[model samples]
Target: MRSVLVLSALILAGFALSFAVSEYTLRLLNMAVIAAVAVIGLNFAFGYAGLISLGHSAFVGLGAYGLAILTTKADWSPWLAAIPAVAGTGLAAAALGYPLLRLKGHYLALATLGLNVSFSIVASNWIELTGGTNGIAQIPGLTLAGYKLDGEQTFLWFGLAVLALLGLAALAIHASRLGRAMMAVRDDETAAAMTGIDVTGVSVTAFVLSAIYAAIAGCLFAAHVHFVSPDDFNYAHSITFLSMLIVGGEGSVAGAIVGAALLTFLPEWLRVLGEGYLAFFGLMMLAILVFLPTGIAGLLRRWRRPALPPQDTAAGLDGAVSR
Candidate 1:
């Protein structure tokens, strides 16, 4: 019952937000939506399955570049290209996860970082096909049937629709047996394996699912921006993606959306802070780390403490600082 209301509220919020925010703001919100999609995908690996994937931007770049190349060079429809591009990214992630997910913590993080670097290198050097440093230009806008979706207002509706569907789909997945397996794997990999959960299969599934979401987000980004370049999908961008997951409260779908929205609009909001705003941003991020260790979602959960009391204390644990 709570889930139904929450979902309904989200659906209503999307439409309500569209009307309330200005076009310029909606454009930024659109970016947040795309990024939220990518981060939500990241949650499956980093948040749910305890995998640290710093190479997510590479998968996102693949989806964007896939559509860009297809629509421009192959003269394919943007919509048509999205299908194979997303599937190919999922397959690539599964293949890559087999070896990478075997590592833990820093090792896994570095490996994924290396993958992201490799992707950017190829994108920059592959001039003939990828336009090299020039990047791909004149990418086609999104269209369905004969109607073109080119304006910010028009795209906002589309963005809202996509977010609503993806949110529901993600929620459904979270309630499934596979979701339970992922939780088990995250909590205790060895125990999950002992309990008949194929650890490797679960890891691969999480990675592939996350990558597919990133791919779709990438497709939408390309169609919206109508341009693609290696610089746009850098390793820094990967870190930002991870940061969004953390700041939004990893493991919480609502946090993903909230974090994306805040981070997306933050820079614009801070434009008044002169050129040193990022320094302030860094300070705030540190403050968040200190106070809201679980991120913004955690902060919100703290606010809702009465309805959903702390799990640890209810289990008869003492409430005290570790140190």
Candidate 2:
């Protein structure tokens, strides 16, 4: 099916990029892959369901800390730790969703922002568990059939494989009944309620799904770098994730991935601008926002659309004149 082609194309793209880029760039690409997973999750909450959650990084932190603690303290396998890390984050989201989802608009946004701040504070003070600001280290990396996957190239391969699979899952969700309900609730809550859609339930489901994706990204981060700190998943990171979604085109899955990659490498690309790079970068983003409000994906979509023939246009005008 189309999903298979997408998956294959993504894998092939990663394979091609591996040879075309440097080792350092590969590391950045790996990070982008991890971030793409989280951003795609954000697409569910914000893009599809119109739930503006600003505490997404907190879920990522929970997952990273969860795996770090398990692998370090209990000597559990990274693969085994991921299960609880992801599931626990989802559960936490569900528990928090009902009360939090009650608030609409900026109120909900503030609540989630508060959640991220609170998570950062706890992660910093919880010396025994999260290692305070020092973070957890010496965590083990993944292995496949006795082959170690610790190198940048190897990790990129693994990250790409994970990203492709999750990408497909996100696509599936976008086509499912739940996805439709989420969109309906997003478009108009009152109308959706009138149609018998469980607005609250849909919102909660979207939040939890987003959290699960964040957790998976978190686990990958923990395993990849073998270290994690409160700073790694702070409110700033949540903002960056949101920015990725916006710049990539919020409602589209392809847009999310494209945005994640573009933003991830953009700063590096701008490094040639010297110390003024950030200023220029900000201006560029501003321009993109002003002119292409639909994001890069939207622009690409516009380019891909075929133009009507001149005769067809004239015939359409003639028909309108006759009418």
Candidate 3:
């Protein structure tokens, strides 16, 4: 019931913003929706399964390039291309996860970081395939019922719909047994193993799920911008995605969305500060980290806590006087 309300509110809010904002703002909103999708996926890996992956952007890049290559080179439809691109990325993650998941903490982080760098190197060097730094251009936009969704407002609506569906899916997973197992594994792998949970299987599942989400985001990016390049999905993007997950509230789906929106618009908002905008932004983020350690969602949750009723308060006061 709560999830339904939240999803409805999100959709309604997106519609409201579409009417309220400029085209550029709508485009930014679309990007936020896209980023939210990726960040929610990251929550599964980093927040639930406790995987420190710095290579998430690579999975996103794979999806984008996969779609780009298929649609451009193979003359396939965008819809048809997305299936192979997303599924293949998931498979790649599952395959890589078996070996990479063995490393823990910073070791895992570095391994994934190396993976992102390797992906960038290949994308940059493989001029014939990736178009090198120039990127794949003139890519086609997505169509629905023969109506091309090329406008920023139309794309924003489509992206919002996707984000809503995926967000609901994430919420469902968060309430399931698999979600609990992932959290348990995150808390303590040895304890989870002692309780008969397959730690490795859970980790790989989380990684694959995150990869699939990243793939969807990548596909959206390709369709929206009609371009694919290594620079767009670099290590910096992975770091930003991770930061979004953390800033939104590590384990919460709502947090992912909120964090994505906040970070997406923050720099733009700070630009009003001129030359010292970045410095102010950094300090503001630091304040958030220090004061709201659990992120925006955490702050909301705290605010939502029910207060004691007047009768209950009176009874407590009377009991204290009697004592």
Candidate 4:
């Protein structure tokens, strides 16, 4: 199928680009993968269930801090630590998501935003627990069966593998009944409720799922940066994550990756734009919001869908690969 080929080609090019680029650029691409993972998770929250979450980075921070504390303080293996770190964050999200996700629209957004702020506060003040503002540093790299992923280039391969696996897993979720329920809920909560869908349960499920992804991303970020700090997962970073999901297209996996890659590499290209570049950055986001309301992934979907023949009766892609 054309879709499979397109995905395959993009993946091949991603790997090739990794090897072809400078260490510095590859480093940035690594960040793109990590951020993409987080934003992809966010897509489930805001993009799928119509529940806006502005505190996703808090979950990301929890994961990073969990791993950092385990590895640096307890001397746990980096790979092994990631499991508990991610699991703890997921469990926390599930517990909190029940109370938090009950809110909708701006209420949910504000509540989530407050959660992100609270996370920053704790991470900054809990010096002994989280190393305070200085943060936990010298986090170890992932070693698999005696193979160390230390070098930037070497790590790129590992990152690519994780991204690919997660992407496929997320795609599979899109084709399932849960995915359909998410779409139905997003389209109309009252209708969904009338049809026996547990609206609150569905919303919480999406939030928890998104949080798990963010936690994994946080683990990867901690490993990559070799450090974890309060500032790293601050509220600004939360907004950035949301921006990526929106700009990439709220409901598409490809959009999440594309948005991450674009945003990650944007600063490099903006070097030519001088000190005012960030000003341009804000403007660009606004432009995307104003003009391409559906985002890049949405645009691509429209383009691709139009290419399919009308009379053949091939079923349309349901809900844009949804949550």
Model 1, span 163-212: residue lDDT tens: 77887787788879998899899999999999999999998999999999
lDDT of 3 by residue, 125-242 (tens): 9999999999998778999999999999999989989998998899889889999999999999999999999999999999999999999999999999999889999999999898
Candidate 4 lDDT trough over 10 residues, lowest sum: 314-323
- The TM-score obtained by model 1 is 0.92
Score each candidate by Cα lDDT.
0.87, 0.90, 0.90, 0.85
Task: Between candidates 2 and 4, name the one with more favorable lDDT.
Answer: 2
Error of 4 at 288 (Å): 1.3
**How well does candidate 2 match the true structure in TM-score terms?**
0.91
Candidate 2 structure quality by residue, lDDT tens digits, 1-323: 54446546766787689889989999999989999999999999999999998999999999999999999999999999999999999999999999999998899999999999999999999999889999999989998889999999999988988888898888888889998999999999999999999999999999999999999999999999999999999998998898898899887788888889888988888788899976886787788789987787778767865454357465656555420
Which candidate, 3 or 4, would have the higher lDDT against the true structure? 3
Ranking by lDDT: 3, 2, 1, 4
Q: What residue runs in model 1 are displaced by over 4 Å at the alpha carbon?
A: 1-4, 307-323
Cα RMSD of all models vs. native, in order, equals 4.3, 4.2, 4.6, 3.8
Candidate 2: lDDT of 6?
50
C-alpha displacement of 5 in model 3, angstroms? 2.1
TM-score of each: 0.92, 0.91, 0.92, 0.92
Misplaced by over 4 Å in model 4 are 1-6, 307-323
Model 4: per-residue Cα lDDT at residue 73: 95
lDDT per residue as tens, model 4, 127-232:
9899899999999999867889988887888888887777777777766777778888999999999999998888888888899999999999999899998999
